[model samples]
Target chain A: MEATTEARVPQKLTSKGRATRARILEHAAELIYTKGVHATNNEQLRRAAGVSGSQLNHYFPTKESLVLAVIEWQAERVLAFHRSERFAHFESLDSLREWAGFYIAYEHSYREGCTLGSLASEIIKTDLDVRADLANAFEQWKDLFRDGLERMQRLGRISAEADPARLAHLLLSAFQGGMLLAQVARDITPLEDALRAAIDHVQTFAVLPAADAPEDR
Target chain B: MEATTEARVPQKLTSKGRATRARILEHAAELIYTKGVHATNNEQLRRAAGVSGSQLNHYFPTKESLVLAVIEWQAERVLAFHRSERFAHFESLDSLREWAGFYIAYEHSYREGCTLGSLASEIIKTDLDVRADLANAFEQWKDLFRDGLERMQRLGRISAEADPARLAHLLLSAFQGGMLLAQVARDITPLEDALRAAIDHVQTFAVLPAADAPEDR
Candidate 1:
């Protein structure tokens, strides 16, 4: 996570300074999400955050730095949720289904699109440093799914024939793509269809019932 | 297709007029694909297309109109390829597999993200008119897959229980998402994994061997 955030604030920051920095980032993220990275300039962000120019500069030296920090901020928030108590382990297909359901049911998912996904669409055109940071965030996020799938494979819920890493990538891609379509349509049907298809694909490698497993019999 | 292109050129057009209009669209699409809708202005398009400002204006009265025209242009090009003799009918899982293989094997899929998809990411953020045009393009694209799946279902290759429309949307979502991930990673692995998962999911609805089809036996 530290490596992901090369745009870190000063180590000796006071509590008030930390609050101010966080405030700037919160507004910047909101602006970037609703508008876009390029459409959002320093002036609009300054007014939106209610911060002076120098203060904003003090926190984020350049526009690129500010963008990077926002990416880092969003990555932290999204990754934290995934790493939370309930979503941390995807032990079964049902668990993954629940996670997918969260995206469909969540208000922000409907209103805003996937937070990270929306940013990815805009930021992929930015410089290499920003893209690398965004890519790293995506890798870390994908790893969560991979870790869960690996657990399922080890438990024999998913067959060893299935590759967890590939499945994880599949799930994430479906999710990002689903979220984008849903956003475009302003309807959740696309997202629902995509997750169902992805989960169904994973189920293809599900071990057969006891009737087929003579050892169980 | 005309309905999709409410941004149509004038009813009366000399052949030269039509060619000049097309030149503007071709250059605009290229610039928009490489740069973006917001970043690629009329001036840049004028220079790229080797046309005068009034000429660019003659075809596209407004920037919004130009964007719609590009979306329509891209839609026609992409849909044409899908509707080509070889790809028009996805009669079997093998046909779909070959189509997916085409994406992976295609240089453009690796070099530039999806043609329509890149426009989609940016245009989705614009006004409803632009978004509507983009959405229509997507829906038309989705129908190509749906039509193929319907053919498969009618031929009894895919089971009757599967909804062709939903599966079509699923395939489109996977492709969109897979392409975006590949663009970010600059590798084709994510797209491959996503398409594979989607195709495997479609395979689940495949009718089993004659042992399960007693009538055939």
Candidate 2:
């Protein structure tokens, strides 16, 4: 069992120290993402990050800490992408569709799979701290979607009976599953199908006027 | 990179040899399921299976072969469970609901997560061969549901407009996603919510008589 050096992360550091720390984390994230956590070792981290033993120890006292940092780094990047203007505001069906489209296109272009999701799948079962951190990350991600769905419900775009929290969870689950299937199949069809189904399910809740309901169907 | 010794597997084996091989595969599967593939090495496998190095080598010439064998073993078990009497033969909405119930129960009882899905999520990005094996496993699993849904369509339980293949993919994706989230959260709510949403989506296609349609809603 690797120990976590939570105290090692200092409250203050020089600009150069911060840059070095960031470089190490970035390199470690790439290796861990590509080769998995167990297969990655300290020696490889040192070689990839071009950091000395003392420098690595100064930033992360243990392998577990390094992995945790990577998880945090990846989570921030994923959340930032979701929070971008194109994906953040989802009050309308058109915006939701656009978000779905952007997700599929990004997945197709970046075939490495979801960074936080891949990390969560690999380590969540074994490491307690990592699992907690991942759970928090997922909750934060779900909140972003939930907030948008709540707006939709308030504006009467969707039915009053729709549960935003559960819908957000369902959509995220489908996205995670779709990413896993796409990575295994090395094709975009599973993701496309999953998102399409999710979006269509959302559409079912659309509060259409009686005059337009028959023609819309 | 791990070298695969494909040519080492002999074309013929006696009954005793087959039993020994099965024992090795069973042990490897257990370890891989609990600890993951990279963490389970040859020595642990030998100790757990109570097999000598030569015997282990006789059965599986490479680590890769053992992992692949474990994958095939797990895939067969999963497919068999799905094909059992309780889960098989879905010709009506009631049968589909029963299948969904069986799945949720199984997931709750076995808290480790979906065997093939866990394996797929962990190794899909790193190993092409493993990814191929997992993709085939998921396709076989999906085919079972697709067949059942097709039967429902043929029997007029579901509308003809429902695409069984796509729906099967959608449901399986949700199941995989739900299992992952449930494992991470250490709760069954995610799995329950995901399956309920999927089952409800499927019910939307039910072919109801005009007289009973309004009341059913």
Candidate 3:
């Protein structure tokens, strides 16, 4: 049985070493997301990253460590997208709908879905520590949505009666669930429907005349 | 690559043979859910079912066949619960709430989750045929929710403007997403919040004063 332990990273690297590590992380994330952690062995990762066996071992001593690093890497990528300029605030109904569209509009490759979510489903089968890392990723992702919803509430776009925290969870779960169903069914309709449902749910709490009412302005 | 073909079951079985098959499937499902499909070997299954090696092969022939059988078995179990006396018809708001509560009420064991969902997550990594079967199971499950919503619509409890099929997908996705998050987090809060959000969405389209209206009767 694998121990429930946190991943350890080696600090202090040269610039070239840092680039090599980033390259390996990039390739490893793709391999793990595409073919699951158990299926993607160290040799396969070494070849994919164009790294030697020693280098692979130096960065990630075990497959479990690589999986953990990939989780962190993917989490950062997802959060970065949400924190990007267009989606940064997520303070308006328009942006929220656009966010939903962003997910649904993408044409997925075969066997492709949310990177972190796919990893979570596979990783949850094994260790609690890994699962906890994933759970934390989800919590961070949920917080982004919550921050936006709270912003909207303060601006009077969303009603004070609605709980942003609960609504944020609904949005995150909707995305996770939609991705799972969409991936399994090989159809994006489930994802579209799920995201639409969540957005519609959020709209129910929208204050009327959310238009250009310049009361505060 | 595994062939994208459907599973084939033997046409004939004696009473004892059927019982043995059922016993094997029951045990296989338990092992598969707990330890994942890729991790559970045939030897482990034979031991778990207390069957001889030949006996296992006589029933399943291949591991893929066993997995397909387990998917069907778990689907039947889920559908049966929804089709049972208390949940049969599922034609009211109160019953819908009960259904949501049903999932949240259960205390899942360590590494335990939705039987078919866990299977689907693992099975999707291998074969398209297996994924299609899991997709069909989800379709049937979604149909159950749609059936109830349609019934409520006919009874004037649900608004004519609402789409039962879409709403059903929402409900199913919420449950799926909720379970995925709950399993990873080892907490039912995400599931609880998701179901409540979905139910609230459904209520937005509900017909007010859906009480004992004698005119409809």
Candidate 4:
């Protein structure tokens, strides 16, 4: 009886409550994207989320907390997909081509600048914790790329010659740099070209069976 | 005798108490770069520039104004230098190579991030005037790149069939993305690789004057 009631009651949220929270985040992300973080406030959040003031505060006790939640949400949904099936078992040129295709499509949807990126740039002075979190996200992303590169190397798809760590670093850099430029320019040329070059370069050095160490002069 | 006063007097800045205002901007740029703009305040600005609080106000009525000054200064220096010199004549691979060399070496000194970028990120909810200026800078940069690409097409360095405007847009995106990643990750490997790849791509197309489109089937 207790289990039944508890399941129906929700550990803390009803289906309705979950939906409401999702709605709040959706609007909040939009506001944060358009307005500066400082300019966004709880009152605006309440109105935009269509919730009462008390509920808004209930879900998010503070603006910083709310922003942090949003950052985490984006990190999970937008950035973490790579760690899943998408980038998992990355070893072949086909996998890379598929990744590139997905990337191009995912990138086109990024009409607004990245919420985490926006916050990272804006909140550096106002909040050290937020800055650290954003910085940490990048580090993790680099790690993922490094892992992917290593997998590729082991599968005989990448050059054991070039350092996996270095390749990963380059790939991540080009990806982020291309996105930044695309955000401000409101064009995809920078993104497409940069990615095209990066993918082609990666393909060029795809591991050959006869790969050997550099010869001594 | 008159030279003594001329030397002692602060060099005439442009109106808006122009020269003194630029001094404020110069100091502000250095501060914003290292400290991150959010942490740097008006009093800090006054102290850093060796200007009295009143003098600081005399030049920049508010923090935002000082920020605007810095934006204008940085845009003019960084973008203009590239846009007018190597970038200005960017019709050939040779010019692209020279510019890339200068940019990467200069970027090594950047510990904080691009001043303009740091400001834009921080100014999320800043005054519309500031946003407008930031937007203008982005527009000017794209335009400059576009102009360079167009000249290349006209000179027959790049394929006449190539889209100069599109190429320029892509270059800007790649460049900015490189900078953003550098700031977040605190490394230059990605920037170095992206720039190198871009230069190589340009050279492959333009340096040889082979009279053929490299990417065409």
Off by over 4 Å in 3: A1-8, A210-217, B1-8, B109-111, B210-217
Q: Tens-digit lDDT track for model 4 on B1-217?
A: 1233234334654465656666777899888777766678888878887788888877677776667667677776766576575454675666777776676787542355665666665653555366555666767776776677777777776656555555564465556555666666566655566566655445444534444547543
Each prediction's total of clashing residue pairs, residues at least 3 apart in sequence or on different chains, is 0, 0, 0, 12
Evaluate model 2: give its lDDT.
0.78
- Interface RMSD values for the candidates, listed in order? 1.5, 1.5, 1.2, 3.6
Best-to-worst ranking by TM-score: 1, 3, 2, 4
Tens digits of lDDT, candidate 2, A1-217 = 0123234446587888888998999999999888878778788989999999999999999888888889888888888777888764777778778877877887442376678888888876564377777777788887887888899999888998877777776778778888888777778777777777877777778898666787866
Q: Individual DockQ of the candidates?
A: 0.64, 0.59, 0.64, 0.29
lDDT of 3 by residue, B1-217 (tens): 0122222445587778878888998999898888888778888988988999999999998887888888888887887788887775778878889988888888862237788776777657664357877888888888888999999889888898888877887887888778888888888888888888988898898886635555666
Judge candidate 2 at residue A201 and give its lDDT: 75
Candidate number that wins on TM-score, 3 or 4: 3
RMSD of each: 2.6, 4.6, 4.5, 8.8
lDDT of 1 by residue, B138-196 (tens): 88888889999999888778899888888887888888888888877778988898888
Give the range where candidate 4 chain A is weakest over 10 consecutive residues by summed lDDT.
A1-10
Which CAPRI tier for candidate 3? medium
TM-score of each: 0.93, 0.89, 0.91, 0.67
Top of the candidates by TM-score: 1
- The 0-to-1 C-alpha lDDT of every candidate, in the order given, reads 0.82, 0.78, 0.80, 0.63
- Could you tell me which residue pairs clash in candidate 3? none
